[model samples]
Target: MSAFEPRPPFYLGIDLGGTNIKSGVVEDSGRPLSSVSIETQADLGPVVGVENLAEAGRLAVQQSGLKWDQIAAVGLGSPGTMDLSRGMLLEPPNLPGWNQLPIRDLLAAKLDKPTILQNDANAAAFGEYWAGAGRNTRSLVLFTLGTGVGCGIISDERIIEGRHSHGGECGHIIIQMENGRRCACGAYGHLEAYASATALVKRAHELLAEQSTRSSLREIPAEELTSRAINEAADAGDGLARRLMRETSYYLAVGAVTLMHTIDPDIVLFGGGMIAAGSTFLEDIRQHIQKMAFPTVAKGCKIEYAELGGDAGFIGAAGCARAAFGR
Candidate 1:
C-alpha cells in the first residue's frame, strides 16, 4: 500500500431494544454500509442479550465486508439509565428482568473489540447531529415519540449525560398540572403520558369509549387501535381522531417549548413512528408552540422531523464508537 493512498476505517454500531437488536457498520463518511437485525429475546437472560449483541455486531461487520482490524471499535445503544464510566446499564425499564448489566465489558470480551455504551435515544441524536438533520448545529434536542417518549440532548456537539447519566429523560417532564394521566414511570402528568405513540392510542381509546362517538375508529377493536390508525382517521376528518391528534400535539408542543426554554437548543427534532403522519402532525406542533410559547422563544428555535429515519440509532452508535475510539 502506498503511503499516500486514501485510508478508510469503519466502526460497528448496535442498537439493543426490547424487540430487536439492530446492527450496522458505518464508514468514516457516516453512511451505514451494511446492516442486520435480530430478535433480542431479552427475556432469556442478560448474558444472552449481551451475546446477541456481540453476534449482531459480528454479522454487521461481516456484511460490511470488513475484517475485524478494519473496524476500529464498537458502540452499543441501550435503553435505560447507564453509567458510562462504569460501563454498566443501571436500570432499563424496556428490558425487563435486567439490572446493572456490565454489558460493555461482556460485549467487548465477546467481540474482542473496544466498546462503549450509551442511551439509545442519545445515540440516535448523535447520529442525526453527525449526519442527519442537526448536522449544521452544535446543539439540538431530539424527541422520539414511540411506545414511550425518549429524548436526547446535545450541547456544543456533545451528548449531555447529566449527573447520573439520565439527564435526557425529557419525556418525564411534567406536562399536566394536577391529576393528569399516569405515565409508564408510575408518575402522573409526565409528557410521556400524553405525547407518546402509546399515549396517542390511549387518547383514541378514551375518545371511542365516550357515549355517542361518531368516529370510524369505533369500528376497530381496542386492541387493534394504533397511533397510525388515529392519524389516518384524523386525516379523513374523524372528530374523535382529530381530538386525539390535537391533544397529543398540544402536549408535544408543550414538551418542545419546555425543552427550548431549558436547553436553549438551536433546533428541536421529532422522531419515531409518530413522524410518519407527515406535514399535518408537524404543522400542528408548530402551531401549538406559536400560540403557547413566548414569541421570542418560539422565534429562537426551529422544530422539525428527524432525517435519519429508522437507521438513526445504529448510525449514532457508530458515531459514538468513533468518538470513543478516536478513529
Candidate 2:
C-alpha cells in the first residue's frame, strides 16, 4: 500500500471483562461487522490479558472478512482507570496485578494500528449514546448493576473523564450516613454496596440466616447462591426474595436520585446481567426514584433499559477509537 493510499473501512473493538473478553469488527456507522467472545482468564495475569485481547481483536478482524490493512484502528474497554493518552491500564481493582499495563503500545505493536483505551462503563455509555438508547439525547448516564455497580456519564457528546479519569464513578458515591453498610471500596454506605448484584446476594444470605422461615434458597447451599436465583425466587412470590429485591431497588433508587440531582442527565440507562430480571425490576426502581427525586429533575429525565446489551462496550470502544483517531 502506498503512503497516501486510504485504508479500507473497518475498526476493531474489544470489551475486557472480569470473566469474558468480547470483541467486534465494526463500521463507521456503528454497525458490527462481526464479533467474538472468549474466557478472560484474568487470573493468569496482565500479560495473558493483553495477549488474549490482542488475539481476540485479530480473530474478530479475520472473522469480519477484512484484511489487516483494511482496519483503521482498535478500541479497548477495560474495567478500571486508564490513561487514554498512553493507553495504559492504571491500577484496575477488578483485575488484580494489572497495574499500569501498557495496553495501547502493546496492542498497537501487535495490530499495527492506532489504539484507544476507555473505562468499560464509559465505553458502554458512549455506545448507548451513539447507537443505542441515548441516540437522540445530548446527555446521558448509564449504570451497569452486575458484579458491582459501574457508572458512566456523557455530556455534550463527550465522556467526562475527571482528573485521573475517575469522573463517572457514581457507584462509589456515598448515599447513607451513620449506620450505613460497608462498601467493597472500604467506605461506608456507598451505593454499590447496596445496589450491586453481589450486595443483593449478600443481603439475601443475611436475611436467610436471620429468619427461621423455610426458603427455597435453603435447598441450595449458600456457597452456590446467586442474585439470579434470588430474582427467580422473587418471581415465584417468595416473601423473603420479594423483600430482598424491594430493598435492593430502594437502595438503587437512592443512587439514581443522587445522580439525577448531580448530573441532570436527559436519560438514565441501565445494563448488566441483573437487568434480565425484567420489567418488574425496572418498575420497582423507577417507582422509588420517582417518589424520592426532585419533581423538576425527575420529570425531565427518563429511565430506560440499555438497548445495546453486551455489545455496548465493544461498540463504544470502537466509537472511542474513531473519536481518538478522527475517523
Candidate 3:
C-alpha cells in the first residue's frame, strides 16, 4: 500500500424494518465506516417513512465525513413481499400504509444515486458472506430464528433470489406431513411452527398445561413465558426446559439437513435470538444434522452461528450495492 494508491469508492446501505431504519456507509472491502439508527414511525405514512429513511442514509454519510455524491451507489433492504423487477413493495405485514410503494425509486430520487433493493433476510446473508462468519467461504445459508423463522441463501457469491423472489425461503419447509401444529402463515408442520422463538414459547405453554411435570418452568406465569426464560431454565439444569430446547434443536436440524442436501452450501449459520442459548444449542443442531443427513453432506459443511447481529442487514445491503456498482 502507498499514499498514491486510490481509495475504493464508498456505498450506502439502508435496512428498513417495521420499527427502525438502520443505515451505514461502507467501503468496497466490506468495512462499514459509519451507521445511523432512527425510528421508522411507519404508522405515519410512506412519504414520511421514505423521507426518514433517506435522512438516515444521509446522516450516515455525514458521520463518515463523506459527501452524498461521493457514494458510488445506494442499497436498501426491506421486509415484505415486493416486485423486485418493478422495485415496488407489494405487501409487508409489518409495514402498514405502505403497500405498492416504489420504495427503491423513492429513495433513489431522494438521494439522487443509483439504488438497488433486496430482501432484508437476503441482505443479511450477503453481509455475512462478504465480511462476517462465512467470509472465507464462497457459499452459505443463514437461518434467523426470532419471532419467526427467516432464511437467506448465497451460492457462488450470488443471492439465490429465484425467478420470482421466492428463493431462500427455507423457513416454510415442511418437517412433518402428518398432523402437526399450525404455523402463523396457516401452513401445518412448517419448520417455523416448531422451531422459532414464538413456537418454543407456545409449545412450553402446551407442555405445562398438558403435563404435571415437576420443573422450574411451572413457576413462571404463562403470560410471561418466553424462549429466553426457557433457555435460562435449561441452563439451570431444568429437565423439562432442557427437553424442550433439545426438541427445538431437532426441529431446526431437520430444516438444516434439508437445505444441505438441496443447496449443498459450504456452511450453515444459525442467527437470531435463539443462538444466544450458546454452544449447547448449536451442538444439538450439529448432532441432529449428523444423524439425519448423509455423511457426505453433513460432514462436509460447517454448521456455525452467524457473526453479525443487528448490523447485518445494512452492511449486507452495502455489500450488494458494492457488487452492483463498485466496478
Candidate 4:
C-alpha cells in the first residue's frame, strides 16, 4: 500500500454471550470483513472472560487482513443489568459472580483501544437499523423471540439506552392482570411469559395434559417437545399445534402493539430462532396487531423479520462503535 492512500476506518465489535464470544471486524460501509467465535466459558469469571473477548477481536482483525491499529474503536455488547455511563455489569443472571465489574473499561484495557459498551439486544437492533431490515428507516423496534423475549429500540439512528440501561426492556411489560404464567425472571404477567419460545413450549405441555383432543404432538416425548416441534406439527395440520402457534402470535402482537402505541417507530422487526415459523406466523402477528392497535399505528408501522440472522450482534456492535467514534 502506498503512503498516499488514505486509511479506511474499521471497527471491531464483540458480542459476549453466556456460551460464546462472537467478534467481527466491520468496514465503514457496514459489511463485516471477518468474524471469529470462541467459547465464553463464562463460569471462569470476568478476568478470563475479558481475555477471551480481546482474543476474539484480535483474531477478527487478523482474519480481516488488517492490523490491530487499523481498528478505530471496539464495541462490547453484553447481557446484564448494566450501568451504561460507568460501563459496569450490575447483574447478569446467566453470568453469575460477574457483578459490579467495569466490563467496558476492562475490555478496552485488554485490547489497548477505545471501547464502548452496549446491551446485546440493542447492539443487534442497531445492526439491523444500520444495514439489515430497518435500513433507511428513521426509527425501529426489534423483538428477539427465543428462550425469552428481548427488545431493542432505535430512534433517529440512536439506541435508546435508558437512564439505567433498561430503556428497551419491553419483554417485562405486563400483559396480564390476573394469574399469569411465570417468567424466568420470576415475574408474572410479563410479555415474555406469554410470547417467548420457552413459554410456548410450556403452554403446549399444559394444554396437552388438559385437553383430551388427540394430536400429533402427543407422539413426541414430553422432553423433546420444542417450539420447532410444535411449529412443524402445526404445519402438518395438527389442530392443537396450530392453536398454540396462533396464541403465540397473538401474544407477540400484544407486545408489538404496546410498543407501537408508545414509541411509534417507523418499523418493527421480529427475530431469533422462532422466526423459522415463517411468513404465515408473521402474518398472524400482523393480523392481531391490526385488530388490537389503532388503525394509524398499525398501518403506519412496517412489521417484518430481521435480515441479519446470527450476525446482527457483532455487526450492530461495530455500528455502535462507528457511531460513537464519528465514523
Q: Worst 10-residue stretch by lDDT in candidate 4?
A: 1-10
lDDT of 2 by residue, 1-327 (tens): 664333446779999998899999878767887789988889999888888998899889888878877888888999876776677888887798888899778877887898888989999999999889998898999999898899999998899988787879998999898788899889998999898999999998888889988778878788888999999988998888889999988888888888888888999988888887889988998999999999998888999899999999999999898888843
- TM-scores for all candidates: the values are 0.94, 0.92, 0.96, 0.96
Candidate 4: regions farther than 4 A off:
1-7
Candidate 3 positional error at 289, Å: 0.4
User: What is residue 189's positional error in candidate 3, in angstroms?
Assistant: 0.9
- Ten residues in a row with the worst lDDT in model 1? 1-10
Please give, for residues 1-327, the per-residue lDDT of candidate 3 as tens digits.
Answer: 764332569899999999999999988778888889999999998999999999999899999888777899998999968877678898888898899999999999999999999999999999999988999899999999999999999999899988877789888999899997899999899999999999999999999888998999999988889999999999999999999999999999999999998889999999989999999999999999999998998889999999988888999999998888778
- Global lDDT for candidate 4? 0.92
Worst 10 residues of 3 by lDDT: 1-10
Instruction: Show where candidate 2 strays beyond 4 Å.
Output: 1-8
> Against the unseen true structure, what C-alpha lDDT does each candidate score?
0.88, 0.87, 0.92, 0.92
Shift of residue 14 alpha carbon in model 3, Å: 0.6
User: Which ten contiguous residues of candidate 2 have the minimum total lDDT?
Assistant: 1-10
